[model samples]
Target chain A: EDKVVQSPLSLVVHEGDTVTLNCSYEVTNFRSLLWYKQEKKAPTFLFMLTSSGIEKKSGRLSSILDKKELFSILNITATQTGDSAIYLCAVELFDNNAGNMLTFGGGTRLMVKP
Target chain B: DAGVTQSPTHLIKTRGQHVTLRCSPISGHKSVSWYQQVLGQGPQFIFQYYEKEERGRGNFPDRFSARQFPNYSSELNVNALLLGDSALYLCASSFGAAGVYNSPLHFGNGTRLTVT
Candidate 1:
């Protein structure tokens, strides 16, 4: 079975604190890893990482995948209260017979206090 | 442009009742996918349809079924609903088929179903 696990299931930090969320996966025919931020309704896309070493960044949020270690990490710098949300990590796998599918982790709940 | 849209934002049904959820993918998107999300958990894939054809499916039971129309709109039907079936059904749309890589899925607010 394909499995994705996220660490520090919940976190509470004051504004301006830097936080790191972790996601580890075990799957066959790995393709890519993606991050999403869920506020209330729909989850918004954050980043997609397919390679190791190199990092993908968007403003204060950045993510990097380490395929060798079978894990990824998402970082938020100088976080604000608005940054409070659940961060989800998903691994995309491609099987010759099953095509492509995304397996998701339980997600990390972040709460930034003002 | 409008994002993916799902109908019947909320619903309540009995354990033996049946329900259908509708979805309209964004314009120009040929692929539509369904997912079920329970509270505090990540969404689980249910089915994927592209060009009105079944492309991929998850590990869900046969009781959960879905179909896409020629217009790329889709409907998910659940028969003999169970109390465990209470969840948020999400509809996502992408520009390409399931085999296409790097295509992000645009999701709708989802339909919340509660089974008694």
Candidate 2:
């Protein structure tokens, strides 16, 4: 079955500590990988990585995908209390008859203590 | 502009019952997708509708069904609801059915369904 697995299911770090979240996937019809941050409500989009080696970054959050390795990593630097949330990784794949869809990992819940 | 909107933010139902959740996508977005997110897990795709057509569906059973209106708004209905059906039902909108390639989905806060 097509699936994505994320490591360090949960973590607690004091402010200013850097953390890295990992995700590995196995699926057919690979297209892209996306990262999201979920706080209390719905998830908000973070980064979408298509090609390998090229890193996508925004402020203190950055991500890169290694297609050959079938994995992706999300890094958060100089973390603040606001950074606490569930970091989710999702793989987008083309479905022959169903167009495209996303298979998501279990997510990494990070708590940034201030 | 307002983000995706879902109605009946919180719902309570019992086993074997039926319930319907509603969603209004962002203006101009033509595609809407549904997801089921249980506690401590990521959201799982349930269905995708565009132009009132079913474009994709996940591993959910027939008990789960959804339809999109001409305005691009959608509704999700669950029949013979089981306890396992309790979850946060999320609605996301994008420009088209193929947006999974590039478009980032704008998600609504979601409806919390409690099955007892």
Candidate 3:
């Protein structure tokens, strides 16, 4: 079965700390991996990594995909209290030539305290 | 431009009852998808519709159904609601359902459903 797993289900860190979240997937026809940040209600898009070894960065948040290992990692530097949210990793599966469907990991919750 | 919009920001339904959730896709978007996010878990895909056609469905049961209108709006219906059915229903829309490069979905705040 196609699935995505994220480790360190929950983490707590002081402000300005750097944290790494991992996501590994076993799916057929892996297309792209996306990361989302959820505060309370809906999730907001962060980064979509399509290629391996290439890092996509946006401010203090960045992510990279390792296709060979069927995994990805999201890194947050200089973490602030605003960064305390659920970080989700999902893998896009293009099955049966159908359109893109994302299978998401259980998400890692980060709490950054000042 | 308005992002995806879903009706009844909050809802409460009893068990064995049926409920319908509405969603209007972002302007000019052709694809709409539904996801269910239970407490403390990731959002799970329920259905994806494009151009008023059913493009894909998740592992959800037949009791869960959805449809898209010609105007690119969509609705998700759940029958025989169970306590387990309580979750935040999210609606997302994208301009196209083609390749990875073209399909970037924007999500709405979602409707919170509480089953009694």
The number of clashing residue pairs in each candidate reads 0, 0, 0
lDDT of 2 by residue, A1-114 (tens): 889999999999999999999999999989889998999988999998999999989999999999999999999999999999999998888776556788889999999898
State the DockQ, from 0 to 1, for candidate 3. Answer: 0.57
- Candidate 2 stretches with Cα past 4 Å from truth are B98-101
Better of 1 and 3 by DockQ: 1
- The CAPRI quality class of candidate 2 comes to medium
Q: What would the C-alpha RMSD of candidate 2 be, to one decimal place?
A: 1.1
lDDT of 1 by residue, B1-116 (tens): 99889999999999989999999999999999888999999998888888998878888888999999989999999999999999999898988854246687778999999999
lDDT of 2 by residue, B1-116 (tens): 99999999999999999999999999999999998999999999999888889988888899999999999999999999999999999999998663455677888999999999
| lDDT measured at residue A88 in model 2 versus the true structure, 0 to 100 | 90
Sequence-dependent TM-score of model 1: 0.96
Model 1, A4-75: lDDT tens digits are 999889999999999999999999988888898989878788987888989999999999999999999999
DockQ, every prediction: 0.60, 0.67, 0.57
Residue pairs in candidate 1 whose N, alpha carbon or C atoms collide under 3 angstroms: none
A1-114 in candidate 3: lDDT tens per residue? Answer: 889999899999999999999999999988788898999877888988888999999998889999998999999999999999999898888766335788889999999999
